[model samples]
Target: MQRALAASILIGAVCSVLSCYLVLKGWSLMGDAISHAVLPGIVLAAVLGLPFAVGAFAAGLACALLIGYLKENSRVKEDTVMGIVFSGMFGLGLVLFTKVETDQHLLHVLFGDMLGITPRDLIEVAIIAGGTLLIVLAKRRDLLLYCFDPQHARAIGLPLGVIHYGLLVLLALTIVASLKAVGIILVVAMLVAPGAIAYLLTDRFERMLVIAACVAIGASFFGTLISFHIDGATGPCIVLLQAFVFVLAFLFAPRRGVFALKRSNSHSAG
Candidate 1:
């Protein structure tokens, strides 16, 4: 249980970092889609007795690439394309699940058991999380530029395709890394909530990332402890804790919080 909780903290920290970029770029739904889309990959991996993370990563990256390509070239809007892809992938995963006849495998992927996390899963999560952090840190400037202004990034000789695809890869890694603790259903919440709350509290991208990581890690730790004591599902509990933080941030964060805005308005009126 300690190991599982520690792994959840690590995963939360990593997700918080990447999610800063994801939320800023309006790619929150993309995170959701990838989470569900990876289901078939897990099912196939189970059938072939392969590493679940490998299968999930492969399937997720493929879907992400497909979504990007279609959005760039097709007449369909990006959100529409994402919707279609998410539905198709989820449907396929459901079909595969029905065929597999595994005991609780589908449920496990949907709502994970933190207490059941293995050392192998932890190692996989560590590799992906560490590698992603390294890459993101190395290319922080480019990613920020791309997020703020893709046209300017291209004008500045940035490899737009590379950065775009790299972000997707990072997102996939995050999803795969987090699968064991949070499952596909709640991983999106882990990815988006901390970052969203951080955005409300800070305008600086770097600060937002730091704040999000802290919030996510803290919530994961406390939630795991709470779940352990109460005998509840760890993932959902962590997510609910995050939601509580978001509500608090919304109500009390400096500058953007409702109270702050009200004070500012009163001062202006005076």
Candidate 2:
């Protein structure tokens, strides 16, 4: 249980960091789609008897690149393209699952349990999370610039294509690494909710990242505890805890909270 909780905390912190940028850049649904798209990869890996994460990551990166390519060259809106891609990939996953006749694969991908996590899994998560953090931190300036103004980045000769695709690769790895604890279905909630809540509280990117990581870590720890006590599913419990945090942040956060807005309005009127 201690190991499970520790792993959850680590995963949560990692997801929080990536999610801030994802939410800010309006790529939240992209994360969601990638999460689902990896399902077929996992199934295929199992059939081939290969490492599941590798297969999942490869599939996810493919989907991300496809989406990026389509968005850039086609007149179709990004969301619409993503919707079509998500549905097709997810459908393929379902078909693969039925063909494989592996019940565990489907269950694990959809609703993973804390008890299912192992030391090896935790270590894999750590390595992926650490490497991703280093890359993101090293390229923070470029990423921030690209996120805010891609045209400016292009004008400055920043290789927008490389940076854009790199971010998606990192996102795919993060989702694959997080799958064990939150499962593919609920991982997006973990990725987006904390960041969204933090965004409502701060305009500065650094501060938002800090707050988002804290919220995600806190929710993971508390949710794991609650899941243990109540004998419930850990993934859903964590998601619910995040929702609670978001609610509190939305209602009480200084700059964007309901009370804060009312106070500001009243002071202006006064």
Candidate 3:
């Protein structure tokens, strides 16, 4: 349980931090895409007796690069390209899963066994999450500028290529760390919801970062506790909690919630 809690905290913090950029850049679907696209890599790694992280990272980077290339070369939009790429890779993964002979560990990749995390698992989570968090902090302002206005960033002499693909790589790393904590399906929620809810509640990027971290950590801790009490799946519980919070922020947040928007509209009419 302690190991699970530690892993949860580490991943929660990392996901929340990166999610601020995801929300700002509108790359929520990219997160979803990479999360599912790594399945084939996991399966192949099992077959070859390699670390699943390396395979997952490679698959995710391939997906990211493919989407970028298609979007840049073709008239098709990024979202459309992402949908085709991730779904195709995910289907390939499902086929591979049927052919691969593996232990129950594979099940954890799909649904996550939060309480089943071991000491070694904790160490991996720590290193991945710690490294990702540091990179985000060190390059936050530059990244935020890149997210908001790539043209302006490039005009000011920033490396557009690095910022663009660097974010994809970071996203892959974050998902790799989170796989054991929330699985592929629910990790997308962790990567989107906290930052989104924070976006609704705050106007400043720094404030968004702090609020997102608090929300994710709070949800992870309490969700684990509630899951244990109710014998529910911890990943789903944590995601559901974040979803519930997003709803509240959507409906009732001070400056940007639905009610607030309606009130501002009314004032304009008056």
Q: Pick the candidate with the highest lDDT.
A: 3
Each candidate's lDDT (Cα)?
0.90, 0.88, 0.93
The deviation in Å at residue 159 for candidate 3 is: 0.5
Candidate 2: residue pairs that collide: none
Candidate No. with top TM-score: 3
Question: Between the candidate structures 2 and 3, which one is better when assessed by TM-score?
Answer: 3
Supply the global lDDT for candidate 3.
0.93
- Span of ten consecutive residues with least summed lDDT in model 3: 99-108
Please list the residue runs of candidate 2 whose C-alpha ends up more than 4 Å from where it truly belongs after superposition.
103-105
Candidate with better TM-score, 1 vs 3: 3
Name the 10 consecutive residues with the lowest summed lDDT in model 2.
100-109
What are the TM-scores, per candidate, against the unseen true structure? 0.96, 0.95, 0.97
**Per-residue lDDT of model 3, residues 25-133, tens digit only:** 9999999999999999999988888888888999999999999999999999999999999999999999998887877368789888889887888898899899999
lDDT of 1 at 259: 98
lDDT of 1 by residue, 107-188 (tens): 7788988888888777887888888878888888889899989999999899998898889999999899899888989999
Residue 201, candidate 1: C-alpha displacement in angstroms: 0.6
